[model samples]
Target: MQSTATSIKAYLEEIPEERKIAFTKLRETILENIPKGFVEQMSYGMIGYVVPHSIYPDGYHCEPKLPLPFMGIASQKNFIALYHMGIYANPELLNWFVTEYPKHSTQKLDMGKSCIRFKKMNQIPFELIAALVQKMSVQEWIICYESAFKK
Candidate 1:
């Protein structure tokens, strides 16, 4: 569910009580491992990590006013979702994540083009998520974003 909360703190507060711990840990994992240069903010009604306008003045191609989004996390209706643009734009990263998922969790990966759904909070692989977050830097993301989405 898209949250109407304007800040990350408020967003977290709005999530179901049972999910708060896991979701907060997931958020912490991303914050700790994400390479330098990405800024944390609320974007698309979720907790978003983005290359700010200071770094990428061109902004998101789809919406130039918005920063270039790198990753996002949200507590959805039935699951918590982690959205990584790197995995969607970089096949190598996607493959790596796919290959390593089984080693981390027994749960079959429930994923979309860029969104990884954690239906079981206990199964959310914080370590795997940490590794994934560190796989790309802001500069690398800008390059990948331009190549994959910019016309």
Candidate 2:
């Protein structure tokens, strides 16, 4: 669900108590492993990791005033979601994550394009997410995003 909270801290406080721990850990995992040059902020009503305008001043094509969004994490109505633009743009990365998912969690991969939904919070695979987060650097993401989405 989209949140009205303007900051990550406020967003965290708004989510259900049952999700606070896992969601916090998930956010921490991303913060600790996400490559440098990415900035954290509230984006599209979620906690987003983005390539700032200082680096890519063109901003997102869909929303030129905002930063280039690379990834986001949110506590949805029924699931927690991780949205990674790199995997959606790169077929190889998507294949790699799909293949490695079974090794990390027993739950069937519940995914849609870029959004990986974790219905069973206990089964969230932080390690695999860490590895995935590191797979794409800021420059690489810019290139990939331009090649695939920017006209």
- Give the candidate number with the greatest lDDT: 2
Candidate 2 TM-score versus the reference: 0.99
> What are the models' TM-scores?
0.99, 0.99
Worst 10 residues of 2 by lDDT: 7-16
What lDDT tens digits, residue by residue, belong to model 1 across residues 45-87?
A: 9999999999999999999999999999999999999999999
Least well predicted 10-residue stretch by lDDT in candidate 1: 1-10
After superposition, candidate 2 runs with Cα above 4 Å error: none
lDDT of each: 0.96, 0.96
Question: How many clashes (backbone N, Cα, C below 3 Å) per candidate?
Answer: 0, 0
RMSD of each: 0.5, 0.5
